[model samples]
Target chain A: MELLLFNIFNGFIIGIFYALMALGLSMILGLNGIINFSHGGFLALGAYMAYSLAPAIGFWGALIVSPFLAGFVGLIVERVLIRPLYGRDPLFSLLLTFGLAMIMQDLIRTFWGATGLPFEVPNALTHPLSQVYFFITGYRVFLVALALLATASLFALLKFTRVGIRIRAGNADLEMVSALGINIYRLRAVNFSLGIFMAGLAGVLAAGRLGLTPTMGASLIMPSFVAIIVGGVGSLVGSLLGGIIIGVAAGITTTYYPAASDVVIYLIMAVVLIVRPRGLMGQEGLLE
Target chain B: MKSAASRHVDAAKPADAMSSQKSTRRRVAASALVWALLLTAPYWLPLTGGYTDLGSRVLVFSLAALGLNLLLGFTGGLSFGHAAYFGLGAYGTGLMLKFVTHSTPLALLAGVALGGLGATLFGPVTVRRRGIYFAMITIAIGQMFYFVAVRWNSLTGGEDGLTGFERTNIHFGHAILNLHNSTIFYYFTLFFFAIGCAVVWSVLRSPLGHTFVAIRENQKRLRFLGVSVGFYLWIAFAISGFIAALAGALYALLNNFTSPEDLNWVLSGDFVIICVLGGMRTFWGPLVGSVIYVVVQDYLSSITVNWMSFIGAIFVLAVLFFPWGLLGFFQRRIQK
Candidate 1:
C-alpha cells in the first residue's frame, strides 16, 4: 500500500511537470503555428540560470528571476530569428527551432559543464512530512503547490486579462484579428515570451527535483510532446490532463515492469491517435 | 558544377525546338560528366584530401535524403520518422550477418524487407494527418522503435549497439568480387545508388508520380477529381521507406555495425535538412546537399569539438538566407 501510494504521489508530481512543459509548448504551437523545438532549450536555460543566480540572489530569488530572463531571451529570439518565417511554411520554423535547440544545449554544456550539478534547496524543505510516507518531502509539497498556483494563475490570466483575451481571439482566427487592426506581430512576440516564461518556470522546478544537466531538457521534452498530443493540441486543459495521466501511468508501470515504462507512454499515444485523433480536447480541423 | 551551369543555360534559353534540343544535349552531357566524376573519384579524391570511404558516405546520405524527398518534396507529405525505416534496415542487415546468414545478397534483401514492411504497416495509421501533425505523429511512432531497440538488449545489443557484422565477398561462377577493397566497396555502394536514382527518376516520370505532385499542389482538387489521395500518399510513403532502408542497409555494411542512433529523430531531422539545404524541388538536390553537408561535417569535426553548434548555425542560416538552396537559387537567378 505504501509503495502504491508513493508511486501515485510521485506520478502526480511528475504529471504536473509534464503538464507545465506541455502547456508552454502548446501555447507556442497555438499562437505561432510553429512547433517550438527550442522550448526544451528554454526550459534548460531557465534551470541553469537559476543554478547560476542561486548563489547571488538566493534560491527563492533565483526561482522568481530566472523565468523572466528566459522570457526576455525568448522575445529577442522571436523578433530576430523567428519573425521572418511567420508567413511562410511552418517547416522553416521547425528547422530553425531545432537548430536553436542544438545551439542552446551546446552553449549550456559550455557554460555549466557537461556533468550534472546538484541544485540545493532550502533546508526547511528537505525533511520528510510523515514517517509512513517518507517520500513526500517538504520540498516536494512546496514544488507541487507552486506548480498548482502557477497553473491556476495562468488559466486566470488567459480568462481575464486583456492580452489573454486577444491571444485567445488571435488563435481562433488570425486573419479576422488582423482584419480588426490588431498588431499580431507584437501579440506573437508577447505570446512567445509568455510560453518561454512557463518553460523557464518548469525548468526551475524540475531542476529542484531532477538536478541540472545540459541534456536533461531533451529527455523530458519528448514526454511533454506526448502529453500535448494525448491532451489534444490547442487545448490547455487537455494538455494538463494528458500530462498527469501519462505520468501516473508511467509511475505505476515502473513498479512492476520498469523496462516497459517509456514505451507505455508511446503506446498510449498510438492508442489515442487511433481512437481520438484530435486528442481529448482538441478542436477538429485546427491543425488538419 | 557543370550541371549547375547548364541548368542555368536551360532556364535562360527559349522553349523553342532549337533551344529544347540544346537543353537535352546539355542535360545528357552533364549526366555523363557526373558519372565520369564518380567513376574516377577513387583515383582523384586523394589529391583533394578525401578518400573513397568519404565518397561512399556522401552517396549513402544522398540516397537517404533522396528517399525522404520522394515523400516530402514530390508528394507533399512531410514525414520526420524515416529514420525508423533506415534503422530497421541497418539492424536487419547487421542481425543477418551476425546470426542468420553470411551471404551479402540475402542480408541486403532481409534488411530492405524489414524496414519496408515496417513502413507499410505504419503508413496507413499516419496518412490521415497532414502537415506538422503528420510530422509529429511520425516522430512519436519512430521513437517507439528507438525505445524498443534500446530496451531489447539481447536482440539489439542495447546501448553498446550491435556489432560483429561484416560484408562478405560475392562470388559469381568463377569470378570473385572482394569487397574488402575500399574502392570496390565504393563502387558497390554506387551501384545501389544508381538503382535508387533510376527508381526515383522512373517514378517521377510516371502517371502515379503526376498524381502525387497534384496532391502536393492541391489535395482538394485531386479529391474532387475522384482520386484517393490517402492511398497514393501511402504508396509514396512505402516506396520512400524501401529506398531509405536500402540506404541504411548499405550504411550498416559500410560501418559493419548498427545502433539505435540511426533511428533517432535527430537523424530524421538531418535527412529533412539535407532535402531543404540542396533544393527540395530539384531531382539532384539531395546529391548537392549530401556532398556539401558530408564534406563540411568531415572537415569541421576534424578541427573542432564545437562542430554541432556550427552545424546548428548552418541550419538557422540556411532557413533564413538560403531557403531556395544552391540549385534553386541558381534556377531563380536564371528565371529572373
Candidate 2:
C-alpha cells in the first residue's frame, strides 16, 4: 500500500511535466496544422538554458528567462522556416521540423558535449516533506504544485481573455479568422511561440528533477507524443489526463515488470489504437 | 507473303507515325545505357579496391528503398516501423546460420517468411488509420518489437545481438556455391535486385497498382467506389515488409552479423529519406535516393564525424527546394 501511494505520487509528479510538454504540441498542431517534430529540441534547449543560467539567476529566475528565450527562438523558426509551408503539404512541415530537431541536437552537443549535465535541486525543496506512512520528497511536491499553478493560469487565460478568443477562432478556421480582418498569420506566430514556451517550461522543470542532457529530449519526446495520443490530440485537458495515466502506468510497470517497462507505454498505445483509433478524447477529422 | 506483310505494316503505320519517335528513341537509349552500367559496374568497381564493398552496400540499400517506395511513394502511407520487419529478417537469418548448418538459401527463405508473417499479422491493424495516426501506430508496433528483441535474451542474445555468425554455402540441392568470393556475392545481390525491381515494375503497371494510386489520391472516394482500401493497403504493407526482410537477410549474409541497430528508428528514417530524396511518386526514386544516400554517408563519414548535421541540412534543403525529389525534377526538365 505504501509502495502504491509512492508510485501514485511519483506518477502525478512526472505526469505534470508530460502534460506541459503535450499541451505545447497540442496547441501547435491545433493552431498550425503541423506536428512540430522539433518541439523536443526546444525542450532540450530550455533544459540547457536553465542549466547554464540557474547558477547566476537562481532556479526561479532561470525558469522565467529560459522559456522566454525558447519562445523567442521559436518565433524566429516560425518566421523563417515554418511560415512559408503553411498551405503546402503537411509532410513538408514534418520534414522541416525534423531537420530543425537535428540541428538543435547537434548544436547542444557542440556546446555541452555528449555528457549529461548535473543540476542541484533547490535547497528549500531538497528537504523531505514527511517520513511518516510514506516518504515524500519536497522537491517533487513543489514541482507538481508549480505545474498545476501554471496550467491553471494558462487555462484561465485561454477561457477568459480576448487574445485567447482570437487564438481559438484562428485555430478553428484560419481563413474565416483572416476574413474577419484578424492577423491570422501573426496569431499563428504567437500560438507557435507560446506552445514552444510551454515546452521550454516543461524542459527546465524536468532538468531540475531529472538532470540535463542533449539526448534527454529523445526520451521525453516519445512519451510526450504518447501522452498526447492517449489524451486525445488538440485537447489540453486530455493531454493532462493522458500524461498522468501513462506516467502512473509506467511507474507501476517499472516497479512490477522491469523488462516490459520500456515498452509498456507503446503497448498501451497499440491497444488503445486498436480499440479507439481516435484516442480517448480526440475528435474526428483532426488528423485529416 | 512480303506484300501481305507490307499491307499490314502500312495499315499500322498511321497511328505509329503520329507518335513522337524522338521520345521513344530517347527512352530506349536511356534504358540501354542503364542496363550497360548495371551489368559492368561490379567488374569496374572492384578495380578501385575499397569501392567494391561500398558499391555492394549501396545495392542492398537500393533494394530496401525499392520496397519502401511501394508503400510510401506509390501507396502514400508513411511507415516509421519498416526497420522492425528488416530486423526480423536479419535476425532470422543470423539465428538460423548460428544454430543450423550454414545454407544461404534456407536463411533467405526463413527471413522472408518471418518478415511476411509479421506484416500479415500487424498490417491490418496499422492500415486501419491514416496520416499521423498511422505513423504513430507503426512507431508503437516497431518499438514493441524492439522491446521483445531486447528482453528475449534466450533467443535474441539481448542487447549484444546475434553476432559472430559465419557465412555459409549458397546451396541449391547438392550444389554448393562458394560464399567466400566477393564477386559471387555481388552477382547474387544483383540478381535479387533485378528480380525485385522487375516485381515492383510489374506491380506498378497492374490494375491493383492503379487501385493503390486511387487510395492515395483520396481514400474516401476510393471507398465510395466499392474498393476495400484496407485490403489493398494490407497487400502493399505485406509485400513491402517481405522485401525489407529479404534485404535484411542479404545484409546478414554479406556482413555475417546482426545488431539491434538494424531495427532502430534511425534505420526507418533512412528508408523514408531514401524514398523522399529519390522521388516518392516515381518507380526508380527510392533506388536512386538510396544509392546517393549510402554513397554520401560513406564518403562524408570518412571525412568527418559530424556527417549527421550535413545529412540533416540536406534533408531540409530537399524539402524546401526539391519537394518533388530528384527524379520528379529531372522528369519535368526532360518534358520541357
List residue ranges in candidate 2 displaced over 4 A.
A132-135, B1-29, B46-50, B173-175
B190-224: candidate 2 lDDT, tens digit per residue: 78888878888788779988787667767788889
Best by TM-score: 1
Candidate 2, after superposition: displacement of residue A41 in Å? 1.3
lDDT of 1 by residue, B1-336 (tens): 112222323232456788678767866886788788888989999999998999999999999999989998788788988999999999999999999999998999999999999999899878977877888888888888888899889999987899988999999999999988899999999999999999998998899988887777778878899999999999999999999999999999999999999999888888888998998877778888999989998999999978889889988999999976777787666545
> What lDDT does the true structure give each of the candidates?
0.88, 0.79
Top model number, lDDT:
1
Reference-based lDDT, residue B270, model 1: 89
lDDT per residue as tens, model 1, A1-288: 788788888888888889998998898889888888888899999999999999999999999999999999999999999899776666777789988998999899988899999999999999999998999999999999999999999889889998899999998998899899999999999999999999999999999999999998888888888898899999999999999999999888878788887788999998898899888898888765
Candidate 2 chain B, poorest ten consecutive residues by summed lDDT: B4-13
